[model samples]
Target: MSKVTQHEATGLDDLDPATAPARDAVHFRRIVAARQQVSDAEDGLREAVQAAREAGDSWTIIGAAMDTTRQAAHERFGRAR
Candidate 1:
């Protein structure tokens, strides 16, 4: 497929306001859905981390994999401790 320039891609340079609204509605729905997915993923990760900590995994191991310090992990997810 060919790449579109910014104006061509958005159609903002030519399209009528009425036409833009419908297209914008679809974009808005996608934005909302993407945000929802991010929130869901965060919740899932929180649950998984809690479960792992509860299972007796060391904070050092978890923090290293998370690219954070053990103290930071405890501060963030220590409720499971």
Candidate 2:
């Protein structure tokens, strides 16, 4: 996938109010959809980790699935007291 430049990412909200509405509408829609996909992926990852813990899975196993160190996984997703 092509990378979004800092200008494109940060200047999305700086569009002119009097310009063509269709142009801004398309750009806004694309940004919203991209953000939604990210949110969904984060939710899915959290649910998967919770399910793993409930299944008595070890941090090492979960880390392997996520391609990270065991301690990293625990630090990232472990329950807080």
Best by lDDT: 2
lDDT of each: 0.82, 0.88
Candidate 2 Cα outliers beyond 4 Å, as residue runs: 1-22
lDDT of 2 by residue, 10-64 (tens): 8856777688364446887899899999999998999999999999999999999
Candidate 1, 1-81: lDDT as tens digits? 898897897666897877556544788689979999999998887887787888989989878878999988878888643
**In model 1, where do residues sit more than 4 Å from their true spots?**
1-23
The 10-residue segment with the lowest total lDDT in model 1: 15-24
Residue pairs clashing, model 1 = none
Give the 10-residue window scoring lowest on summed lDDT in candidate 2: 16-25
Predicted structure 1: clash tally = 0
TM-score of each: 0.62, 0.67
